[model samples]
Target: MMLNANLWWHDVDVVRRPPLEGDTDADIVIVGAGYTGLWTAYYLRKLDPTRNVLVVEAGHAGWGASGRNGGWCSAELPVGIGTLASKYGRSQALAMRQAGREAVNEIGRVIAEEDIECGWRKDGTIWLARNEPQRARLMAKLAEEREYDIGEGPTPVDPADLAVPGLLAAAHTPHCAALHPAKLAVGLAGAAVRHGVRIVEETRALEVRPGMVLTDRGQITARVVVQATEAYSGLLPGQIRRVLPLTSRVIATEPIPDALWRHIGWPGRATMSDQSLMFPYLQRTSDNRLVIGGRSIGYRYGAVPRTNHRDDERAWEVLEREIPTMFPALADIPISHRWSGVLGVHRDWQPRVTYDLATGLASAGGYVGDGVALSNLAGRTLAALITGTDSPANRLCWVGPPGRRWEPEPLPYLAIQAITALTALVDTRESRTGGSTGLAARLMGIAGK
Candidate 1:
């Protein structure tokens, strides 16, 4: 029973493969056929044409966030530039930022060269500040970028120019691209298969040990075993504490008329987000619909939610409330779809990609909510690590160690509840006073760093 949540399905064609039936062995086996796993396999075959690679998935390919994201293939990393600088000198931080920018362009290039019909657009992204606290945060971010000598960082835009109501200010960057996520995922999967990568769907991995992966039907043995399961990693043994799975929900409105779009005046199709703790991201789809998503949806215990369901009524209410506040022009527009998906969040909130050659095991995940472009970088870097090739991505600061495990049961539950309550309180205060009651936001920033 697949969830009927993803709007990208309208344009994608899916081919489901049979599950792993008997004991299988390959040179390398990848668990989880999402973007990370598919891209890794694609690069692996590209690098070594003869290396035997097999990808096994619990569901069909692109069943995870790879197929169900906000579709902003933006050049954003979960780790901040300032944090990277403070950890590993300014030069290394700048190099990492450059690598990220290159990765963004690389995605666009891949889509074009492969001729994936994902509605690729590179109008860039706009960060709108609708209130005083948001403006301060944007200014602080600009100052940090300037300090790091980031020439292509966000540039300020006056509210008068944007014409968005309640827009204190806005920033623009040309690095982010928009595309249909499912199209890219499906296309990549097809490319990997065409490149001689074997893919087995409906094979649930129960445990991932060094050089061996235990599954519901049988076991797979390989020289290298790569765990690409992001949020669903908790289902495997000894992996629950590694990440906290948080739900992110999205809603799309019916196609709006050209007249309504002109009245709104945002024809650039730039991926847009506001300065909120529960950051809301909006996009103008190629078909003239508006898709909005946020992370205020509730979380499930032990990082496992109902797998076959997509309904999140509370999340729908949140988006419904926010739509009127942000874009009054679409107040009466009917919602066409509503869905939710979970993403992995490290305890420290930084994304990680780790490979251990000694154990013949590597895992790449914990992208927080920014896996769109980061997953591409992770796939390429993981390939380099497995093949012992030295690429700039392999040398990135995020490549060495895995994330620290989360705290025990009661702690994660209590902390998340408290944090959600605090976030709501802070949002209310900021909205009411239009002032700097940004303690919650500041704490979250500090924790992620």
Candidate 2:
């Protein structure tokens, strides 16, 4: 049922498969079968078919964020412009942005070649603006994005119409795209199998201790172990520092009629809500429903939220009232469903492509919410590193885990939820009063400019 509601990208032939049994040994073993691992396996096979690759999942493939989350196939940097310039410098940032731009195209190519039925829409996206401060900030983003060598530039809604306008600004780029993330995940799994990559589901990897992964059903002893669990990265290569878990959410509006679509003017458009730190994002599916996301909260000073469904429901309510506010016609519309997932966030919001110099283990995450595009780059980075290719990718430095530099915070679930609710309360007020900024925005880094 949870799976069915997220149907825009599902395929009948790609239903969840059975789990693995008995001991297994392969040349390489992968943990977590979400987008990252699936693509890793797929591309690895593309690199070599007879390498004896084995992949194990805690649940069905795509069951995590892969199956039940927003399908925004974006290539833009989710990290703020200021951070990108500060860390990687302009040239490397440009390459990172270019990788994002190229990812959607690569995703499309793989889908087409495999004949996967996931709804793949290459239409551009819009960064819907909601408030005055947001609009002002967006104006700055538009200019700054132009400065960056983004494959495409942002289109502003200068003096945007908020009451009737979907957003104060609609940042569109051919580089960012959308698709049924679930189907793509499943398709990749199936493709991996076709390429001689064995996949195992319903198996939890309890421990990773040098060449052996202890699973509930059995143990996997392999030569190489790759930790593909991005958001839930830890337990392997050690949890990244400053790379805390952020709970983001998504919800689908009842199938919007084509007439409403005419009013929205985004049959081919998607939107990212504006926030210096974390904010909401929305887009039209291949079908006519609006899939909204980006309503998120930082991990309890340290721990990840276990009940993102509840958080997502709360986020859905925020969108329910606000999405209608964006377009009056959408006011009375019903919401079809909602779900949530966590992302790996570095302090600065850049992804980590960390390869432990001490250990043979290699892992990457900290994409913040930009993993869709950046992970592809990480895959290439990983392949290059493994095969000992001397491409420029070898020099890339990922956000190392913040364990030694930072200590974990003890998060009491209820208090953390309250903090999130408080943020939304302030946001609701700002959204209603035209727009907002200043202290609150700065706290989140919206004063990003």
Candidate 3:
């Protein structure tokens, strides 16, 4: 097994495509071969097979957060529905939420149509409330969902169903699915290739300009250029603060025995996470291994993005401790892998899909770690916008201007660290007292807005 390699990567073999060798021209050029880029490329050709579409990747496809994430294809957005309604109006917020739900099924439809076998399971997600405070928060959220009449919103589940210590309540929502992220990424790349999309791997995009993409290999001129780098957007010149990069670490346990799994009691294998401020997300792999991940690390100064953090002992240590703490049955299980990846966070904590017809520049990202399903929506929306499809997706709230840029360095770095530290502290206080800290709400307002 490779150190710091995504556990999902273990399920597939990666072969790099030929890199760009010289200056080229295309109908559409997209930088970053992650889900957003590949999905856009896949859909663009689907919409119009005659268009020349090219995708350039710094590494191989799925090398970034796309392949390294927690494998959650969830409809949950980074910001809450209420927050969206407050900012973009109620109808638009509801429309965006509905779009997310549809996006989950859309991904499933594509996977089945493409015949990509990536352990696709629509088992949904389970959110655990481990303390009184967490329970109150969950109930409040459920009430809000009811108030908005969101379809199939989270419903209560018996805490006993989770079989975790101190669990006071649980909620399940069908709008999430679990899958092998790397396999999905690789498979999408293959699907795009089959659809006449050219993917150039190991080609670093230096900068993206109007109708042009400058790369290490050569310049690419196209009628339209899309920037889908997400967290790595900071690596490009003049985009240092466009999106902040935050590190998330993950650890995977060796396959648990059938008897032990039965004792643990998640028969559906629904993706699971607690309501803790520094929450940890868990998933059961098709092979029966347990994967857990969380935001165990804070932002780096200057928003630098690193491919691997194998040397980050502190982050891995935090994740390693979570397995035993959350599930005593796994106390002795060996952790087979540990890895870390960076996710993009916009200033408003909302994802966006923007296309500027005047400059032939387009972009979609800032998913804040909830991008698996959202990326599909963005791709379809981007394709619709670029091809003049006049679809309803273009009317979604995210299909407008890129929101405010993150504050200059030191400020973002400091604020992120403070929030991270405060979150941990609040979780600790809530756990010990079994009462509301009253700080989480304040923090959410400041952090997301």
Highest lDDT: give the candidate number.
3
Query: For residues 363-410, what per-residue lDDT tens digits would candidate 3 score against the true structure?
Result: 999999899999999999999999999899999988899889988868
Q: Tens digit of lDDT per residue, candidate 1, span 145-193?
A: 7897667777776677654778898889888888888888888898899
User: 332-401, model 2: which lDDT tens digit per residue?
Assistant: 7777766667776554445666555445466666666667766666776765665555656556445344
By lDDT, the better pick of 1 and 3 is 3
Checking candidate 2 for backbone clashes, the offending pairs are 126-270, 127-171, 131-435, 132-435, 240-401, 240-402, 241-401, 241-402
**For each candidate, C-alpha RMSD in Å?**
2.3, 3.5, 1.6
Q: How close is candidate 3 to the true structure, as a TM-score?
A: 0.97
* TM-score versus the correct structure, for each prediction: 0.95, 0.87, 0.97
Give lDDT for model 1.
Answer: 0.83
lDDT of 1 at 143: 81
Ordered list by TM-score, greatest first: 3, 1, 2
Runs of candidate 3 with Cα error greater than 4 angstroms are 1-4, 307-311
